[model samples]
Target: MNSQHAQHSPEILVFDSSDALASAAAQRLAAAIVSAQSDRGVARIALTGGSTGIAALRALRTVGDPIDWGRVEIFWGDDRFLPAGHEDRNDAQADEALLSHVPVDAARVFRMPCDEGEFAGDATAGARAYEETLRSLTPDGKIPELDVHLLGMGPDGHINSLFPGKATLSERERAVVAEFDSPKPPPQRITLTFPVVNAARHVWFLVAGADKAPAVAKAVGRASPADYPAAGAQGRDGTTWFLDKNAAELLR
Candidate 1:
């Protein structure tokens, strides 16, 4: 493992293998959550979904850290606009990986509104409802002050459901939006907008696999957000990119 501190852009943490990356991230997250709980009564985290993200969650479950799950709040970075329990949804993955095993307050597990029921399978309705929920979390109606916001980078430089060249990348006011026409399947998705994602106290990117190398380079290079959505994500306090050797290969 090699950790490099950067003065300008996000610090890059490179690991020999994806497993090592996930393990290190999980350990750090456990420490962060414990520290936050000591400073404040509660801790909040926005979890991401993907191979690497799930690995980290599982790793977190194994940590010996005395985390009071009951005092923690959980949220997702994004979810597929499918049924609440759909296997493809990020919420579903989260539950299987860590949520179901933890005793977090049910009220604080803020899962995104999925298709069906009152949402009527309308992505737009779910997006609006999520925005309303976010606004209600804090008194000032601004986006919630996220403790840790985890994200996954797509091979094309997308984050959450915000893809490169998508008009949603230009969105400013909305905290959440319905992502339509996504390059990936199950296009309809509910994703946190840039303004909200960038509001986090810390942003962590979990990226693995050789396919992500190009995207990593572009994101850290001169590519615009319009061309690489990942470039738009900036944490208020700090941003860290956790990468496996393959993913960091092209990160010159």
Candidate 2:
């Protein structure tokens, strides 16, 4: 199960319960983002969508802290290619959970525009537009070496919109691409390709529950990238995996 890509394996942290772990991770993530902004003047982060990710967001809100929300630029790792207000939109979930609760400058919050009446229903155009935005803001021609990229793992080892054995998993050139035929459903999505995701400075995965244990073992045990898409996710600078007892039960 050895993988060269795992050179970025993160410091693993395990907790007793999902709620406690997600909450703590969220608070730490908020603090980390704030600290990065203080040290570097700006911090760009990629966020995920799911119950676990939402729990982490809720933890951020419950924990008392005054972050320089204005200096933080938020991005999504992937999104459902639905209308902005759609329940399945990652943007919508994030806004409800944390974004709307903060005072971040509206201009700094980069959400893909799904409402545009472009052919192919605007997903491709949105992805390309987001790539352009990244180009305009990043110091180099590369995608922003994001301060942090937060993610959640599906029971089957999926992350963002990239599912195991899917053709989208092989994409490299596009920072983001429109995903179709997803194994999870609501097939159409837009996601940050591996090249873009692996470009980040730090990537943290938050996971919980026994249902996700097998995939967790796969991810942590050096499973092949094709069968376990989570194995393909790596942070250029560092990577970390946060797990609860149930999810980490199989890890020897």
Candidate 3:
């Protein structure tokens, strides 16, 4: 949250194994939460879904609870526009991973709308309602700048459902959008646009496995956002790529 670490230009932290990566990320996240809350009295974080992301969250539960979960505002970067309790929903996975283990205030956890909610199966309305909810959190009617935006890079250089070659990658104004034809299954999804994601104070890309090596390379290489959406996740304060050995192979 604060620029306390040495400035090493868009840092990359590599770990030996996926479990170790998860542990280190959990510790780093705890530090950020403590630092932000100490400086601002509240910390805002955007959570991500996916194997590695959920693993880190579960690891967060293993660390001593240094964060005042009550004062922390929790949000998701993207979510499947399905029923609230659907197994594939990001919020459900997150809750199962860590949120349910903490004493975080229910009101502070902002989840995207679902098929059964007031928005009811309308992904566009879900996106609009989530954006409005974000705006209401600040006095300026703008999306809140997250202290930490935890994300996972997909095999296709995607971040938060903003897949490669998708129209959402070209968006510059909206803070959030509903995607109707994601390359992955359960096509409908609601995602925070690049404008909101890149505006965060910190962005941590939690990636693992050899399957992501190529995409990681493209994300750090000379590629447009249209071709590698993950490239657009450059945070305002700092951006860190947390990778396991397999994922870091190409870069090495």
Candidate 4:
């Protein structure tokens, strides 16, 4: 880990199992959103999609819906460039898991442009449009400071759509970028860069399963972001790793 990152090491919370982790994350997320809304009148959160991520969203449903959904602005960390309503799309999974159960204002939900929209299959155009949408939310024309940015890490240590050693890792200016050749399928994707992710007041990584143990160890050990994108996701106010015992087992 570099000196800068070492100075703000992530807070680690380990659970007995993935189910326990998801339930805890869901409760914490609800509280965080309510707290943000209390402090600022509105809360913005970026969601992630994956087994653990979606499970957390689903678990949120059992929490009695304490959040004022209408006052919460939702965004995504990254999503495949598929047509709208595609089951594989992150937003669609999110809708099925949580959004549909809540009373969130439709206008406040900012889903990344789909492949069939105005951009129409052009990944770059879609990315640019999403970036514009993010900038439009801020008075300074910068990416909005999200209250919380939730992430799920791949076994290879990737975060969002940013795979290890990918050229997109070098991106510093653009808040969102198109991943034309993702190592994982769906091939094309749109993802928020490190700048936008780190701008969040809180970056919470929800990881589980024994398969993710090694990557969790490396990220917590402070590996270079180019090698482990999760290492690059440091929130301005706080960074946390919520892990299942299987995932935290390998952590030092």
Candidate 5:
């Protein structure tokens, strides 16, 4: 890897293989969770949906060291407004791919409610409720101050439910928002707004594949937030982008 690749990668580490990347990320995130417990006696983390994010969760299951399951709270960065068992629901995916294998408390796992009749209303309610949950968990009303936020970037530069050219891109106050007309499939979704996403003590973006080359290039190369939503996504204390060879190919 060259200087630019080194610069744009995650703060603590990066990997080439999907499994290796996942394992490393999970271990680091777990370590962060443990550290949070040592420092403040509690840890709160936000998780994203998609293959990469799922893989990270899967990695957590096999981690050698034990995590303080009771002290940690898991929340989603975004979710598809589908029924509980729907294939596209982030909540379902997380449960199948990760939550099922962990020791996390059932009550502490905050998932968006999409089974209700009203999609928009459900999304709005879910966002507000998650915000309130975070408020109760945090010593203060602010977000991102918790331990860590694990994210996965789409090929088009979307992160969480915040897509390019969408109104959620500019959200400032609310921790979460209901997004509509997303270009990606399953258009209707709810996501943590930029304010919440960026408020974390640590933010990590796991991006891979040739399909993501263009977005990765624009994100770190041009540093234009609007053109590349990932560029705008940052952690309160720090932000890192993890990529494989193919994704980093266009960084020049």
Candidate 6:
């Protein structure tokens, strides 16, 4: 990690179980959105997809009524390049998990393009279009400075679609990029680059499972992002790790 990132090590919050982590994360999210809206009239957040990520959204549905969802702008950290409404798509999972229960403005929800759209099977085009959307929302023609950016770390230490040792890990110019050869299934995907993720005011990582314990330890220890992508995700204001006992077990 760079000196700037090293100066802002992540704050660790361990939970008794995944369920507890989800509930706590949801509460924190609600508070964050409320605080941001109180100060700025709107809140922008990026969502992640995975068991733990979805659990947090579901938990939010129970405690998020205090939030003025209509003024909240939603974006995804990454997305599978499947057709819209595909059960496996992150946006679809998010809609089923939380959006449907909230009164969020449809126009504020920025979903990455799917394979069946005008981009049509072109992950690169989809990524570029999403980048344009983000740029349009910011004065500098870069990515939007999200209020809160959520992420789920893979057992392999990847975050978003950025895998360890991949060329995408070195990306500094683009705010978004296409991942055509992800180690995980349904290879084609689009994801926010580290620059965009780091542009957020707060980055919250929700992780669970014994399989992730080692990676969590490495990430917390400030391992090189090229070797542990999660280590690269630091927020401008703060970075936090919300982990279950299983995930934090190896932390020193």
Which predicted model would earn the best lDDT? 6
RMSD of 6: 1.7
Task: Give the whole-model CA lDDT for all candidates, comma-separated.
Answer: 0.88, 0.82, 0.89, 0.92, 0.75, 0.93
Report the Cα lDDT for residue 70, model 4.
Answer: 91
Clashing pairs in 3: none
Candidate 2 off by > 4 Å: 1-6
Prediction 4 TM-score vs. true? 0.96
Better of 1 and 2 by lDDT: 1
Judge candidate 5 at residue 1 and give its lDDT.
7
> Against the hidden reference, what TM-scores do the models get?
0.95, 0.92, 0.95, 0.96, 0.89, 0.97
RMSD per prediction, one decimal?
A: 4.1, 2.7, 3.2, 2.1, 4.7, 1.7
lDDT of 2 by residue, 139-211 (tens): 7766777888898999999988888988888887778787767777687788887887777778899999999
Which residue ranges in model 4 land beyond 4 Å of their true spot? 1-6
Better of 2 and 4 by TM-score: 4
lDDT leaderboard ranking? 6, 4, 3, 1, 2, 5
lDDT of 6 at 106: 99
* Between candidates 1 and 6, the lDDT winner: 6
Greater-TM-score candidate between 1 and 2 = 1
TM-score of 6: 0.97
Q: In model 1, which runs have C-alpha deviations exceeding 4 angstroms?
A: 1-7
- Model 4 residue 185 lDDT score: 95
Instruction: Give a tens-digit lDDT track for model 1, residues 76-171.
Output: 889999987999999899889998888878999898998889996689989998888888888988778788999999999999999988888888
Task: Give lDDT tens digits, candidate 6, residues 17-70.
Answer: 999999999999999999999999999999999999999999999984499999
